[model samples]
Target chain A: MQLDSILFYLFAVQILFSALMTITRRNVVYSAVWLISTLVGVAGIYLLQGAEFLAGVQIILYIGGITVLFLFVIMLVPVSEESKQRRFSSQLWIVLIVAVLLTGELGYFLWQGADSFQMGEPTPPAEIGTVTTNSEQIGQVLFSEYLLPFELASILLLVAMIGAVVMAKARPGAE
Target chain B: MEEILDNPYLQPIIATLLIVAVFPLVAGYMVLAERKVLADLQVRLGPMRVGPYGFLQPLADAFKLMLKEDIIPAASDKWIFWGAPVLSTFTALTAFAVIPFSDKFYVADVNIGILFILAMSSLGILGLILGGWSSNSKYSLLGALRSAAQMVSYEVPLGFTTVTALMVAETLSMQGIVQSQLDKGVWIAFSNYGLMLVPAVVFIIAAVAETNRAPFDLPEAESEIVAGFHTEYSGFRWALFFLAEYASIFVICGIAVTVFFGGWLRPFANVGFLETPLNVAFPILLFVVIGAGCALGAVRVTLAYEKAIMGVLALAMFLVAGLFAIPMINELIIGFFWFLFKVLIFIYVFIWVRGTFPRFRYDQLMQVGWKYLIPISMGGLIVNGIVLLFTS
Candidate 1:
């Protein structure tokens, strides 16, 4: 239990640090690396939750695929060292202040509602094994209970593919 | 605190750290071995001056890396420049956590070990990308872009081939897959899946391409890209990138072992006098006899028989050593040896290709990945899925 807490805190620290680094780093590339670290921490949290598949997907899709794309685009666009130092707008201060205030209020409410929070009984060890159901169960769920969402996701992917093709194509007579 | 420390779950975490700590040192030596192999292939002695036969080459290289001055390019983003290599190395290390060394050896033994490895392996691309971008150099940027495309493109076939293995094994767990092989008395690679060989072969090629080893090493094509994304890095930081690359090689080989070869399992069936409990004592008793033979210098008198005797003696020592080691440690050693053996074969193939074949053009490389490997893998997966459904 204490180890869990430590891991949680460690992940929280990573999140906060990476977030700060992402915004403040002078290099665009460094900002992306920080973002990768942020994603890794989130993946770690998922692992802690025993969602191994989700954690793996998070790392693969977000860190590997998405971030690599970001890096490729960044590399193709010739941004100078000086330009990378561009600061956030002054209005960001107001946004930060509001965010802090909201967090404080949320924390206060959570504390007040602590006694009312319904803590469930500890799950049995055997239940943990069930959490790692074989891929067959996942396939079944995808084809049945989540069929609609699955089809929607495929359609969404199709639309994105078309959009990408259109964007990559040169405008008529423009090239 | 006591509860957390004493929890059984903590064992995996501790075992993971122990594995991570040792893997890099082993990987460092592997680089030295690669150099030696390359030299031998080219009919030259490689780094013979570092130490006796360059045995201490990795150590010498380590010391040199540590003592060298750290350089952060004036035009580069300092933090990302530093962070990229660390990220690369860390992601590479993390992938090993789930790789089953042998049937009983692994850190976490996660059910989705294959997926975990694939995912973690992909994450290293982020570091390469960031390293390239932060270097503030045109060459680095180009190298990074090429690598990103190469990795993403190759990953498709890699995953598909793995699915094919999963189909044959009827299980995702690495150990379970090995056990399936042991039960059948046939390896998955040699199984009745005829056309499945296409994807398996493609997958092995893809693994090579993904790791950016020679012939496919266009990402760091020294002639063109001037060391690629890591062009600007120096000192220990540079060493980290090398460590990540070699470590990923091991990770890829381990995945191949789990997927195609019987991971951590002996190829032949367990045929011995030790088939029964009473017979199990025979191997140990034989070891005592060999030890006595060696003690009396009888081994020298019978050189041909001594060699055969020594082989058996070595196996006994390994088994005894494995018995004394922790379960995870035992698995790791067995897995490491299995993984190393396979990787050495792959490395030889890598070296052989480097010596024999010409490098692929960037466009050709892209074409092979997208047009050839991808479609084949996708088709293989479909066929494999069908076969699996029928078999199950």
Candidate 2:
């Protein structure tokens, strides 16, 4: 129980730090790294929930694939310190005011809901094995119970892929 | 608390750490082996000066690497630059956690071991990207971008190949797959789907490209990219990159073993043997033999006598071969040997390809990945799915 608490706090601290860094970093590359840290923290949360496969996919797809692509594009753009320094003054103030109010509201709600949201007992090890059952179960569920959603997701990905290819194709006059 | 401390999960975690700690040392020696094999292939002496027949070359290299100055670029982002190699190396090391060295020799027997490995292995690109961007160099950045594109393009096919393997085995657990193969004498490679072989072959090729190994190594095309993402990195940091590369190699081979070859199961499993009471003892006995060999090699190194090292190395080889006497452990030890042998072959092929083929032009490289490998692997996957559906 103590170990679980320690792990929870550790992940929480990592999430908080990375979240702060993601918004606060001046360098775009550093911000991307922070975002990765945040993603990994979330993956850790997934692992704690015994969703090992989901956690792995989350790390692979989100952090490994998407974020790296984000960094790749950012690097290719040639943004330097001078260009990055330009900041909107009034717009920044407006953004800051909105952020503070949203944070305050979320904090207040969380504080109010704390008593109502008591921690549940940990799942027994025997129950956890069901989650670890081979891919057959996953396939069975996906093909039967979740068939529509699975097909829908595949279609969504297919559309996204086509869109990406169309966007990435070189234009006639462009180098 | 005592019961929790003795939990099975702790065993995997401890085994994982143990494997990670020793992997680099093994990888170092693997480099030496490659050199020796290449030298033999080319009719030349590889590294006879360092120790007798250059046997101590890895150790010498380690010392040199450790003593070298760690250089950080003046304009580089210090933290991310430093963090990149560590993250890369750590991810590569962790990928082996779920890899079954033998039937009972695995650290984590997670149901989704394959996915876990694939996911962890993908993180290597993060290190490359971070290393490149943080270096604030154009060459590194370009190299990073190329690697990112290559990894992203290849990952889809790799996942598809895994799905094909999963479909056949009807299990995602590495052990389960191995067990399934054991029930049939033939490897998954030789099973019903002939087209499945195409994806396995394509997957290996893509894996080579994804790892930035030779011919496909345009990202670090020495003559072109000027050493790529780690161009500006030096000393221990550079070593970390090397560690990550070799670790990734081991992982790819481990995946190959799990997916295509029977992971820890003996090639020819007899039903009578499996049904016998002795079956349970077989895997453990096999582990002990292999473990003892490794321990002996380690002990010989500690003694630091040339004769002892040679004697122990020879003994290790003999013990490894003699493992065949025990049918079950034979498979596990042989699987380990087979996995290493295959990986070494790939590594040599990587080097040989480097020596033989010219680096691809950037556009040509992308074309090979996007145009050739992707379509072929995707087609292979579809064919595999059809075959699996019909056969099963």
User: Among these predicted structures, which one has the highest lDDT?
Assistant: 2
Which ranges in model 1 have alpha carbons more than 4 Å from their true place? A16-31, A81-131, A134-137, A170-175, B1-18, B270-339
Over A1-175, each residue of candidate 2 has an lDDT whose tens digit, in order, gives 5766787789889999999999887778778889989999988887776666678789988987888778878887666753477764668888899999999989987888967566766544333223275345556888999999999999999999999999999999998
Candidate 1 chain A weakest lDDT stretch, 10 residues: A122-131
Q: Give the TM-score, chain B only, in order for the candidates.
A: 0.81, 0.84
Candidate lDDT (C-alpha), each: 0.76, 0.77
Backbone clashes in model 2, listed as residue pairs: none
Candidate 2's docking class is medium
How many residue pairs clash in all the candidates, one count each?
A: 2, 0
For model 2, what is the C-alpha lDDT against the true structure? 0.77
How would you encode candidate 1's per-residue C-alpha lDDT over A8-86 as one tens digit per residue? 8999899989989998876676677789889989998877766566777898889778887787776766567546565
**What 10-residue stretch in candidate 2 chain B is worst by lDDT?**
B275-284
Task: Write one digit per residue (lDDT tens) for candidate 2, span B90-183.
Answer: 9998888778777557776777788888888778889988898889888998788888887887787778777777777877777778878887
